[model samples]
Target chain A: MDSTPAQVPEGEDLERRAAELHDAMLVVDGLQYSHWNRGVLEELRAGGLAAVHVTIAYHELARETLSRIGEWNRRYQVHADLIRPVREISDIRRARDEGRVGIFYGFQNCSPIEDDIDLVEIFRQLGVFVMQLTYNNQSLLGTGCYEEVDSGITRFGRQVIAEMNRVGMLVDMSHSAERSTLEAIELSRRPIVISHANPASFHPARRNKSDAVLRALAESGGLLGFSAYPFHLRGGSDCTLADYCDMIARTADLMGIEHIGIGTDLCQQQPAEVLTWMRNGRWARELDYGEGSAEQPDWPTQPDWFRNAADFPQLTRGLLAHGFSEDDIARIMGGNWYRILEDGTQPRSA
Target chain B: MDSTPAQVPEGEDLERRAAELHDAMLVVDGLQYSHWNRGVLEELRAGGLAAVHVTIAYHELARETLSRIGEWNRRYQVHADLIRPVREISDIRRARDEGRVGIFYGFQNCSPIEDDIDLVEIFRQLGVFVMQLTYNNQSLLGTGCYEEVDSGITRFGRQVIAEMNRVGMLVDMSHSAERSTLEAIELSRRPIVISHANPASFHPARRNKSDAVLRALAESGGLLGFSAYPFHLRGGSDCTLADYCDMIARTADLMGIEHIGIGTDLCQQQPAEVLTWMRNGRWARELDYGEGSAEQPDWPTQPDWFRNAADFPQLTRGLLAHGFSEDDIARIMGGNWYRILEDGTQPRSA
Candidate 1:
């Protein structure tokens, strides 16, 4: 629980050097669930984000999820200059070249598919790149991180994974339990992802992945996105930027640097009511305080060093100060995510 | 138009014989858009309907269409005794054995899929057994009957047809323009269907199929369900039972008897506003009277001989008096639809 920032090179030249490096790298955020608007898109552009995987569904059924997608479609139409929808890896490059942010859709839960397996392809065709098998509780597909018993993937879940593999939708296990996450990594033919979770050994949060799951995920060529959410950090809002970078470096040592990237679970500008909806969704009659106490069931305060998309450059500075090379910094920023996405988002050969 | 009833043996025994024949046959109505409720389900059972392909979408996008399916799912749960959802052909036999009506969902327009071709399989997995290519106007897939210029199936429509064929959803072209209908039949690898339409030669209505389309449909092993809609009838609401039977007999001659079956197109007990929604849906600012005049924009009055499901037996007797054998009557009633359903509702081998 060390909350102090480690000493780093304090010259203005070093700070300017970090900013220039951040501008040069193709930075990508693996997951973000922000209150999207033109302002948010502009902020992402300011942060030099080439692409971001945005969560559009947590517990929404097919109808509600499609409505959310329609809303995003409208946003893409209106903010054509600031952001564009991402379907292929080339779209990310185009975003970088155009100096805009590419918004890639992801689902934090499998609720959007409901009871039908074919909806996986339907969502993929609609440009959903990543889909988690479960959220924070039990789903039809598998047990979630908050569930007491960790039952592996269900029979229908296996069928869904196969269909997802066939359609080239990347399987995510961000909020899945240990057993379920391990099983999904083994079962998916293509490389899976933990789009927005840190190593449990780093902070011991229920939403974090265990070392065993991380080893399997890395061995299978999957990606682990280091989360910046306060609850998943070591010292909540008091955790220092230097400490966060150190954790990322440690994780890179455990699971190779190729499998490590940033997925700052940023819930920027979302109202507190949305968090309640995310946790309860229509399943619970009572408020389920997921990661927070009943007395304070709200989004935890983000550390000042990483409060929003605009603060992503601070992490690049912290990593550079931690003695990581410019090449390693560039890979951690977005290159690794781009490589995994290209490998995972194409349909399997017949 | 001939309005006279054909001569028949006048006796209680002949009346008893027709009733016995109607009850013995596997009566299937290929399409109906009734205000579904327990009362309507009871009437369907009373008519000895083993299965009825129910219209669930017209100009609805994906979200609205999924909501409609959710509503039907609720109906199936609440009225389990009177009706059950149909998926496979065996569901029809199960319905007949359980003495409940099998409700097979279909779409009168391809709107449920919106712009995504993968939704074809998604809707099929949701138990939508049939999906028409268009309604009374142009769609993403093809041109409808009411369009002045018949632009046949588009490029995306071809992909949708292949997906629908692979997923076992019957491609319906009942309300499509002639050229589009012909193109759909030609492009579909599996047998396509015109789930509800009469011959244009029989009535010359804009919504009716042409002789060339019917010939192609039959030659491709597709079924054309004869419509009982007054607008498509020769004499509107005054059409006689004998004339309707003769139209069926003539159609059976044109397309083989194996390709002709009843589709009724019955719109029983629906409020007039629903008709406006069907014709307008979100696309129009002004109401579009599809078949009826603007002054009388309402559901057309059903003919006296076929006012509701209860009047099905009258048509059975009329067919018998038209010199059709008992075996032919049985085939016309439901056997033909069943055979085609079995062929068109199973997924094609990879």
Candidate 2:
């Protein structure tokens, strides 16, 4: 598919303002499930992203998830000039100052902890900062977004939330069922996040948050990162940059500006098999397509305006054109997430 | 301290009757933390115990706990003639028929699960049937008996209870604080159990259940397995078999016959170092003599009449002499526990 032209105001002065603002701000992508390499790291650096929450586990078990972290550790060592590991909010600033992307770790599912509650601290110490209670099916913690019966959080799920809160891990419920998501917002002592999901009123995808969830999230000081994943967008692959920013504006109106940011859900440079792995893991023997159907058992094509990390500035320019103030644009781009990361990643006092 | 004599009727005919009843009944000890060997198994067999719930994890993490389960698996294979792993209630019957002790696994704390909720099922599949929400300090699940302020069962604790209920694992709150224990009993969909604890009204130990907890336990269809641990007994090492039986009778009066059984909490033949391991694990750097002070930083002396598994028949004699009916004696001997085991260990139907 042909890449869409950047949909900004047709003037060099406006472009310079957007470019300068994107360059000066601490751009933090709330989530991305990309196949990371030097190319992806270079694109993130090129996009002026100071930090990005990278999905390290979908349905991987503890051992496998640890191996993925080990892989990222090696990447940080090898690509020291392009990327750094994010253990705290200071690391994001350090990455920005050093002209490198801070790669923060997250799990799209609770699979990595597998049933052990102590691994929360273990993973937190290893630089995993965010974990979703469920992915797209029923986990020990709670029901996923796709499950017909939503039993909310299980007894074990409640324990996990408290432990995560105590150990400074941000509880993400992006792919959890509605009841589970709402329950998590109510149950977590610390602020939670939907790291990468749109509003259901805008897109109506199963992965999107409801109006009630968004409001509760704001009340609990949680953040909701609007998704750019085509499946979660209002117009799928054809979603215009203008319409995407308008959706963000609408979400900001509902959730307040501080609770909104960009997660993008970018899955760049991944093979179709990786989707199968993400959707099925070791839990299912047969293929489970998750958000895709049997005939479309692969990742949907990303919208052209935000196809890769390098296209991030397009969002900044689009937001500017869509009439968001520079301050609001900066916060929506990363400032809000930066504040949340600062608050969410500290050990709770006894 | 000299061992106390068995406080049962002296007549040889009465002794024979107690022995026959002990041998004939399905004698299930709700909890035991013995240093397992062929000798221990022999003692259990000599006592005519058909099954025993064994503590597998105190404060061990997931990897260490899994190693413990592996150790048990090897033991089950090597000592196949003496012991069998109990995954289901039918296994208890099978062990009895085969003249072997059914070893059911339990955790004295939720450490094996650590932070992940998924491990509840994984551990259940590996033969863990009972799990205490806390040991003697605050865990992710709840406040332990040693913690001053009980915050009740945590949000995570509630989730864990539901997962445990769904997967057929019994929620044991024996070492949890009062509020946490009560909350767990109330929160659990399936009846919870105090797998090894005594009534606080009888002993007044920090580890014993309050009268309110006991009443609630009975009302909620839960079971209380009386602990014979010195710290939980009314008079410590000086607690007479008669006093113990009287305590049991009192508890039965409060909780009804169906809710009373014997856990024993027998730590037979374990070295003082083993107690250190149980009390501290990797959590404490300094010596933590749990239930013991600096002056008594060791395993307390066991009451003579209940020193080891082979002494179990003395309890049957004691209860019989204490004026319990043959039917009540039979129920207290193991029948009550057997019924709870049947009810507590099975996947909950949705």
DockQ of every predicted complex: 0.07, 0.02
Give the CAPRI class of candidate 1: incorrect
What docking grade does candidate 2 earn?
incorrect
What are the runs in model 1 whose C-alpha is more than 4 Å off? A1-10, B1-203, B206-350
Residue lDDT tens for model 1, B73-143: 65776888888888678899899999999988899998888887656765776688899988889888899
- Considering summed lDDT, which 10 consecutive residues are worst modelled in model 2 chain A? A1-10
* Model 1 pairs whose backbones collide: none
DockQ of predicted candidate 2: 0.02
Q: What is the per-candidate TM-score for chain B? A: 0.96, 0.96
- Model 2 misplaced regions, further than 4 Å: A1-350, B1-10
lDDT (tens digit, per residue) of candidate 1 on A1-350? 22223345555765888899999999999999999977777889889899999999998988777768767765765788889888678999999999889989999999999887656766775688899999999889999989899999999899888878877889999999989889999998889999888888889999888889999999999999999999999999988887898899999999999998999999888998899888888889977899998777888899988878988888888888887999999999999999989988896632
Estimate, for each residue in A1-350, the C-alpha lDDT of model 2 and write its tens digit: 12233433456776888889899899999998888878988899999999999999987887666557657755865788999888678999999999989999999999888777767766776688999999999999999998999999999999999988987999999999999999999999999999999989998888888899999999999999988899998889998888888888888888899999999889889999898888887778887788889888778988778879899998988887778899999899999999999999897732
Model 1: DockQ score: 0.07
Model 2 residue B107 lDDT score: 96
